[model samples]
Target: MENREESRLTSAELANLWRLYITENLMYQFKTPLIDNCQDPDIRSAIEFSRAISEHYIVSIENIFRNENYPVPTAYSENDIHPQAPALFTDVFCLHFIHQGAQLGMSKIHEMMAVAVRQDVWEVLNQGANDFKDLYQQSLQLLLTKGLYSRPAFLPPEKESRFAENKHYVSGWLGNQRPLNALEIMSIHNTIIQNGISKAILRAFAQVINDKKLRDYLEKGAETASDIMRELEDWLIMENTNVTATLDSEILPTETPPYSDKLMMMLIANVGVGSLGVYGNALSTVFRRDLGLKFMHLMKDAVQYAQEGLHLVIDKGWMEVPPQFPDINTR
Candidate 1:
């Protein structure tokens, strides 16, 4: 056994310690929706696999911390779990979310592991990377088997021509006709509340992930989201708009995830589309350059999030295979 006092943690060790803290936080967040309302058998199985893997990683890291005589960060704990919260997603949505989360986690983990130095820590991270790869593969197979996946649609020649000719669309301005008002400010505040809820959910997931790399990525995202939320709230107060820090009571009750992955996919896709519309409108309506920039930033991040989700769908084979384009004649 490595001597507790003699096992000095290197910079690599310190980084991993922070990573473990963050991933564990995410795992805790994911567990609630998985246990309370996920309905699809296949998705539930995947969640079970993820939960198990995260738990193992957490234990391994904790052992390492103890052996090295380093104080473990208390970023994740039992308090993070929300077993009593009403189901927020149908089984289908739950599976889609899991797949998306896994893809994001994997991408971030790969980046982190590339920089890791400790042989033992690197080995553990590699194991996790492999597990997530397998999980992504399995998810694709399952989606293909169920005919739940679909490829992006190809635009017809006429449609493409029309889109190319259409120049009326504004790029950065708010699309709304009037200047910013109290009602519009209130609407923006609501958006902030929605964003906060999303952060809370992500924070929960962070609590359970074991990989240091994966945890750090989640923690960074959480921090970014929190910053945006604060900014939005401050803007609302500055405008003297009545805004509530909490979510409205009328938000739909959390439902069991649907069995169909397609529904879930559409739901998330629509959210991305909706954000584009909202941001576009804001650009046209709001005259302030700073506010417009903030909206653009939020929209850009949403696009990235949606793209990551789409990649998972494609990787898992839940979407339809794309048709090959005709090759140009070389002669």
Candidate 2:
């Protein structure tokens, strides 16, 4: 007979549940303001869907934690948001926020589902993943209908496929290099788009963040993001192709903050970390020495930014501790 009653939660299950509990609450905190400030009906609907899904996950995760006698972390609450505050971001930004968020959330849900061992945990996570997929599709369609979706540059088919002929194909530093390949162009193009989004987020964040030092850091981050985007755009322009800008160049002047400083820092830092991952992936895909070198430098800068952001949050007591193994040595 299986001992279902006495079964202990695996570490993976515990970690997944704990992290999602925190993440869902964070999502709720942001979505509340977005929903309140959103002017576009389509954007409002997407935000509502995302917030509803997050609420469902939070409730389910809380139930699991309670059943297992685990103390839930004090995640964000109504105190962290101000619904009546002036709109800090535009409707387009809010729409993009939901679209990007759903993509990242779905990826995480799939990862959690892959490692989940408990039957109940697996079911919950799998359901979240399916819901996010639907949400992503809906948000994407809305963006397309509004002409707000900026796709990566497309490559036309060549007369025929050909193998690399000489050493110059991969060379870039010491000698003449061949023109950029389709894959290299694609990687650089995608990196530029991500950088644009990061820059826009940080620019908006810098405007509302009150702490002088932290605001300065966010401004510096925005400058770094711009530098990266410009570099990548230059590479694409060298190939005589049009570059698609993913973020709006203008931000409304709004000093009123919709989210707490802690929440803003956390969200910006999360985006910085995600951008670093994108840079690393692009680095791996580009074979040209120049392209690879650019990605490496950009990634190094992103790492520095992310580390600084983490330290700031920790110093401010805004960082949450995740689940960890017990200190057996001390015991």
Tens digits of per-residue lDDT for model 2, 1-331: 3486546678888887888888888888888977887888878998899998899899998888888888888888898887777887788877777787787788778888888877888888888888899899999999899998877666788999899887678788886667788778778876776777788889988998889999999999888888878778887787778887656554668898888898889888778766877788888899888778888988887888788889999999999987788899999
- C-alpha lDDT (0 to 100) for residue 225 of candidate 1: 66
Looking at candidate 1, the ten consecutive residues that score lowest on lDDT are 161-170
Q: Given candidate 1, what's the lDDT at residue 166?
A: 32
Each model's TM-score? 0.48, 0.92
Q: Which ten contiguous residues of candidate 2 have the minimum total lDDT?
A: 243-252
Please count the clashing residue pairs in each candidate, in the order shown.
Answer: 42, 0
lDDT of 1 at 163: 29
Error of 2 at 204 (Å): 1.0
Give me the overall lDDT of model 2.
Answer: 0.83
lDDT of 2 at 35: 87
Mark the regions of model 2 whose C-alpha exceeds 4 Å error after superposition: 1-7, 246-250
